[model samples]
Target: EKSSHLSAALLGEDCEISPEQLYELLQYAALGKHHNAAQPSWCHIYHQSRLAGVVVIVLHEMSQLHFYKFYLQFKHLRKVFRHRFTLPPPSANFLASLCGEGSGLNPQGTAPGLISTGAECIPKSSGLQCDPIIRKYGKEKRGLTSYTLTSEELRKNDYPMRDSPGCKGYMYTECDLQRTDSSPLFGLDCEMCLTARGNEVVRVSLVDAEGQCLLNELVKPESVIVNYCTRYSGVTRKMLLPVKTRLPDIQTRLKKILPHDAVLVGHSLNADLQALQMIHPSVIDTSLLFARNEGRRFKLKFLAKAVLGKEIQCKQRLGHDPAEDARAALELAQFFIKKGPVKILQRALKDVPLSTFSIIQFSLDPEYVASHRLVGFCEKVRNKLTDMLTIYAGPFEEDFCLKSVKKEFGKCGPIQSLTVVTETYQPYVCIQYGVLEAAQLAVESLNGAEVAGSCVKVQRPITAATLDCDVLIKELELDIENEGVIYVAGIKKSLTETDLQEEFSPLKDLETLFLPKDLQSGKHSTCCFLKFQKSQSAADALEAINGWAVKGSTLRSRHALASGHLWRWIWQMNHSSEKQGGNSLSEKMAPLSDSITASHLGTSLNRDILHKKELSAAVSSIATPQQLVMVPAAGGSVVLLHDNTFIISQGEKTGSDVLSAAQDGTKHHIFYQKKKYTDSTASGGFLMLFKGK
Candidate 1:
């Protein structure tokens, strides 16, 4: 009616606007003129069912609405502002001036009629300034809904770095996890049963405003259920044996309860929607609300606990509570409306000198920090004061992963870290950035770029967003000294640590190697780390050995970051012996052969490398005498991650006793024994096997 009344005032009687025109005008008013006038606008008209709340209606800051009391010329305009236009009641002089009644001849050669000013007029400059009071009490009206949807670019659908369309007053977008102000909002959750065709909806819990149960039912599937799937979906055979509501019947009731255009809220709504076989465009999926990336979704339970300070879907004794899950999803959305955006705004605009733009980046990942150069770069750069960026991309194929994201995004600018947001159909890479320049560059250049076989969608971290300052900050801190490490990927299962030691011999500088294997299956990892004594040596080795084919597969290689917890690794391995436990770490690693021999030149080392005599002995027992190849060590020993393999120099080798006795006099020595490379640590953490002494 506001649009219609205003349109009638401006155009003429019967000059009514279609929902389309009203949206475009609203978009022009709220968001600056942009394309997609109808689809993405901020101006919204609600039905009578919706309770009016403050809505932020933006006008061009340079427009007359900023200074003159032109809004008062039309009574309908006054109603749009909730009758709280900032202009003060106009003086006779001001009204006369507008009509040229006092200053000049009127067009009709007569005095103009009286007009009243709404409120005090305040001047504006270039930027937007919101009317807080009016915004607080949004347009309280009903019937015929339409809003100008802003361009997608202005939207911060990213995590911690979410983008937003520049309107100060609280704004709600689709799937925003925003609390609804009574527009027939509903939270829906469904449970499924496994059938021959696939997953079929068996139960549903729907809630409405005031937490009222709108519809809760057990719907019988079309076909017999193959599995009750009771572990997660609490439905049981006994419960469904009784006459249950047919799916069509339930759908009928659901449609009656739901407005055709009502907003539906849930977690991973894609799954629920598919199970129910329903199509809803205005869905607020909590998974996307707290997404790791485009296709990555957080479990409803996670968001509830983290955002809403509540737990849901935890109790399985009674079965999955659709009500609990649905309410949890609803509450998460509410929490975002109440607090999520403010914090996201603050973090996303970290470079801005405002308290609202502050971020505590104390604990970012090291690799992330180095990759994005966050330490030296301004945290973020926006084309406007507000432009949330997503530092992730995805829907990639097998050839795509963290490395692929970094490679593509690196061309644009710095990146903190990139992680694959694993999904069945699409795998996305979630990234954190140290600087905005790089993020922006990446978003612009790589958003639609092809990655592997998929056309990747790169943008701000939405479902993949992070506001946990400590978590991201910690991850951003690099392992400073790990420059000497080299990543070796696609390791052949048939290859052993001894094989790698030989392959890596081209770079003579030696350091510990990290090659963990599956203990139960005794399968070698397809990736490992080879740390060189000199950083330059690691680089050299990477150049020499990258893509080297062995055992029917080519190995991939790259520089690896040193671990931040190197000291912790050393401490644990060194202390493993003294720690009095029946099943200690040393035990977890298979003990060496009893009858071992060693050349005076060689020594023994364990999983962590450079440990005490006890660990050394355990390492010695595992290796054959010819396997020992001594590298210079300062006093005790340095952890050598790579296993040793050297043909005995046709020289005499000694037994363990002789080797132990000759240890003090050795220049270089050999050790002998045999053990499989596949092994594990006592605590369940995996560690690769190697020979060192």
Candidate 2:
């Protein structure tokens, strides 16, 4: 039926144009091609996703991407500006009225058709932050369980309608959702007003599967209503002060109306449930349901426009109509079911035998890919996973999923994606090996191996669109080779950043200096990092600082393994050295083996600054000879950290999640999970350095 409608809309009754011509017309419009023009001079390629739930067409011209992207963004910016400045506001009378279709209680209980007679709520088009044509891969069968219907189908269904007693009681009797089965599906929405404690629910709207209002009411709060939130909530002092409907009555009413097993659908459903103090197992949050991997959930109105091809939440003055919100959520659920379910949340337990969820979960979360630290690792892993391996059912009691494939060949090389289809009875696994040899090694070793009583079959599978994996791995690598970090410690307590910068402003290749402090650490020791554009300049400055003492501790510098790993060394400076006796770390100091070389350190200065006897005493320790040389390979540049440890990784082990979210995470540091930003000062402890004269 849909195909027929589309065909008629395109070809017309007499078939004015050929189907090939129609296809070309669409291509020309999409690619911004002109009539009678050959494809643009630039060489380009196009690919598309054949997934059932989503259709993604990707076009690429190595030379013209940025040019097109600029225009695309500019177009979106125009929409945002129009939405902000050009959208008309509603009249004062409409603003003061209740959001009900009746404008209040109606004798017939039939609310007016949506707020359309005077002012329509729909937008002219999509604005900034448009929903992408995205859908997750899953085993959902095409035959719809529910949420698919036409207006005729919905009217024919034997569900309750506006005249139904339950529907008659609601402010409006409209049903937008349709389900054939007796199993219950209800859409719930709530509007909250400011109360003494916080925001409290002032209105609730519940709609049945067919969108006939089951319940709609304004309830008085437990505490005094502080602000009506008249603009957004639409609830005014006039609606709640009379207190005709109390919280208890609404709670009791809902208990009787809502079934235990009914599937609840709503946007931001958690807040509604919390406001109601309701515990429900079956819920489909439209916000979460429509959430794609890269984009955040949309406002109900924006979502309606983008996904449902409808508009909502535009009437600002009439308090929010719960019935409208509920209908929107119910319809949104139907829209989600029409596409597919999100299965990413059902991740398998770590290292368990491969299940459907386990296969996709094996790859790092997209968050890891977005980080500077993991890009190189991702690139290396992708380069190795060029070959594919197929795992066919063998003597294994279970299906042919990664049953023992990983155990058998995980050592062969990194496995990038282990695609498994266990939902079907005939299960097969597609394994993308990080290295071609790894796949070959696995095929050679495991093809005839006996497992769970049967010998498993292994071979390579045909491949396509591996460019996705390539794109995944082709993120920016950390630029550590060209830059160096200086570890300056024992900064005077009295000095501010201005004082330190003034002293070190002459250093060449100086990029930024930052002071870091542990938010949880009460210790007041000052430490800072000096980042330089050139590694050689850092080396020269470190050499100079070693010969002269600043404040108290010797200044040190070293090439960072990567840009973001500075915090690991800073963590070591304050915590690790103290754990090991400070004296022991001082004893293994790399500089003690070399003689002082600074000509500026004249005799009188040396006597006052060097404190050789005190230094010797500080270096003395009862540790063994093997422990004496256990210094890190920074060439004795670590002035504060313990001498023995090597930074094996700067990942979860360092409690990076906690540190990166710390008070100074982005400002004193370089990044954020929510955003990427930088400043002149490095975040965290403070360090001081000298400018080159």
Candidate 3:
């Protein structure tokens, strides 16, 4: 029946039996009277379990003796059951209950008695004597135990199934024990039942005094033949199937690598040790070391995040690297070591008032010197004078601030005092120069000076008033209409109002102008403001004069000068032009009525004849200043006049010229050209005229 079920399961046939039912059926058949009928009378039921592909049954015949019968169908389950049950002796009634027998029944029909069995053999009775050799060598003394054996001795000793002829357990003898001054330590990580599928150690790792490393290794399980969760571990059944090294072999290798006196270090080291079947007395679990509650229960990632400010996880693609994990664990251990186990335990106490007091005390301890030093330094910096500038020199250099200040400003005068402030932040020394001059010199010279790869800023002390004023000015300046109003000392003297008007005339119509006020008079009378007809005109005007200069006579020039002064007025009237917004006179004049008064005119010109009179005035203005003058392109048309010679003219349409000979060598002729006028009747009422001699 078992064979049939195994066949059905292997062939994927519809076996009517459920897994539980199949287990029961197998259990019944293995322990049933029909199967036990062939057994000898002296064979006492030692152990039984439904495991692998069979009913695992062990019979103790006599002293130092045990017989094992395994059904091949469940051979795999048997090994698994044996591993789980035999290590720590399983309950005597566990198998009986599984076989549908009452725990009260004595199946072997004999009272249990102690039997002396070596580590290699299974005890026949419940009262088994501990092996003296094992007790003497395996007992942990000074946190160390010796388990050394020669290759020949190891081959001769029986281990896994202690009584089995070929199996050998770890061997140790008193003669092999070596005492060392070094502290005992070990690292532990586990490949659990889930990870052990198909006999593979999918999750192998190590933990040490340093940390835990989730190493990558493939192990072949003796029971299962395939891996179901390959996507997670990146280990496939094909990759693991070929590697047949048993768990004992892997355990032996680990034991050889780890120091004998080393205490296991890990997050949950017990689980790992148990899985690997390593029996060690000394272990240091970081979980216990960092436990915040009843026991160490925090996840590894959580501990890493809270304590170390790092994120780590086993679910990552590369998985948890064992080396890094080991290192992290070790760091955590060291942190606890430095903090002291007693302090951590004290923190774990539940008394609210006591905990708070303890916390306060801890914070005030000398161990917090770095933090206190930083605070003190910041206080010193805060109390520094606002007018002074502070420069930070390289860290670890004493009196760096004072030294730098003296070195830079010592020649000028004796410094009041240079204060050096040192604190927690990477090394920096603050040097406060005594006076503003000294500070200014230091700032100008040392602001961006590099010392030991770090650039230092000579920072001016900030105060509430200064900071607020700066903020307000920055806000006001955001919409400053005139950047040209601001000036430097040497540049302001050369920039009179006339120069500004001449330069900015192309920007807008200059309706009014002002100049900067004199500081001595304490009046708003120096700077100028030329208001345009529109805000757009003003904006354009300001944009045009963004880079204009101001000429100043004094060493220091006030950039913020008041407007509407005499110098500015005279400059604007003499140097300003009506051609402010446009390039062509026609375009500029188009906005004005054909007949308009020039309010600021320098002459008594009639409104109707203003254009002709202004043209004559402009010509006279230029001509009167020169010996012989020619007014080319007057009023947008060419005009010429040689002294006492002729008045040559070229109109837009009618081409005409006039010439006059000199009346006297000392006197020049006054020639005039008059064109003939015609009436509306077009009857040639006037003719073109040129008067010349």
Residues 1-693, model 3: lDDT tens digits? 222111111100111223233324433323333233222221222223221113234332111101111122333553333211111123454444333334553334321211101101011211112322223233222222132222333233211222344333432211223334345444445443353332334456665453434334556666664433454345555566677667766676666766545545566654554445455434456664543322214455555554566666555554454445555665665555444433322332111110000000012335444645534433332233233333444443321222333344343212333433323333354444322233444455556776434566655556542343333333323322222232212223346666766745675565544444433453432223454545566556555544344342222121222112212322222232222321221122122110111111111111112234333332332312223222212211122233322222222222232222222324332222343222322221112111212
Ranking by lDDT: 1, 2, 3
Each model's lDDT comes to: 0.44, 0.42, 0.36
Query: Each candidate's TM vs. the true structure?
Result: 0.30, 0.31, 0.24
Candidate 3 residues lying further than 4 Å off, grouped into runs, are 1-184, 193-200, 207-216, 225-234, 241-244, 342-693
Clashes of 1: 81
TM-score, predicted candidate 3 vs. hidden true structure? 0.24
TM-score (C-alpha, index-matched) for candidate 2 = 0.31
Clashes per candidate (backbone, < 3 Å): 81, 27, 70
RMSD of 3: 39.1
Candidate 1, residue 583: lDDT = 37
Candidate 2 displacement at residue 537 in angstroms: 5.0
The most accurate candidate by TM-score is 2
| Candidate 1 per-residue lDDT over residues 57-112, each given as its tens digit | 33221222222122223434533332121222234453333322443434243112
lDDT of 3: 0.36
